[model samples]
Target: MFGKTINEISLNDTAYFEKTLTQSDVFLYAGISGDNNPAHINEVYAKESIFKERVVHGLLTAGLISAVLGTQLPGPGTVYLSQDLKFLKPVRFNDTIKAEVIVVEIDYDKNRIRLNTICTNQNKEIVLTGTALVMPPRKRMDI
Candidate 1:
């Protein structure tokens, strides 16, 4: 059920992915991305900062948006063209975040799509907002 082609897509087509952030999630992201900022990994250092608590990496939270696009809406073969994001709030450990995507426009001639991307926490606070441009998978030709 992956790889929905441009012809099969439409305005307002949507998808979502949800996950609860964990300490291990933060640590692993830090390790893999080499973004071991004190605000994200050191509770003591974080306590001294404005947020007053360890916060998840902004990009880590934003990845949920990628999750939705790659695995749900256009799925599998979708090629991400670009994304513009704004981080609105801090996400602490244990926050359940849901990333959502909505097709705001489509360019049939170019096979490109513009999508409204957003992420909200369990408390329904918008943590991130963005727009993404993607090329949905091409139609498969019969063998």
Candidate 2:
């Protein structure tokens, strides 16, 4: 199925999705991704690092952005073209991260849109910020 088609979308449109990171989520991600860095699983090892404790993988946290884009903003049929991200803070277990996407530019002829992506923690601090280029569904798809 598709979300809002290009014709229905407008600049400044926004969407949000959030998740509370847990040990299980991190472990599953680590298992699937094979990123067994000690900082993500070994508490003792991470305690010695700057974070002072285990931290969730940055990419894992960033996935929330994908969730928003693929399910809420441009939705189901949206095709992500590119993204530029900056990790501003460490995401620890049990932190609730809210991901948001806002339309900033649109090319009707090209069927492309530029969105500002941002992730914030429960404390309202920005953990990640980025921009993405995507092509929303050309027409609604109902299956």
Q: Highest lDDT: which candidate?
A: 2
Candidate 2 per-residue lDDT, tens place, 44-97, comes to 999999999999999999899999989888998899999999999999999999
Q: List candidate 1 stretches off by more than 4 Å.
A: 140-143
Overall local distance difference test of candidate 2: 0.94
RMSD vs true structure, all candidates = 2.0, 1.0
Q: Against the true structure, candidate 1 has what lDDT?
A: 0.93
Please give the range of 10 consecutive residues that has the lowest summed lDDT in model 2. 134-143
Cα displacement (angstroms), candidate 2, residue 57, comes to 0.6
Using all chains and alpha carbons, the TM-scores for the candidates as numbered come to: 0.96, 0.97
Q: Which portions of model 2 miss their true places by more than 4 Å?
A: none
Q: lDDT per model, in order? A: 0.93, 0.94
Scored by TM-score, the top model is 2
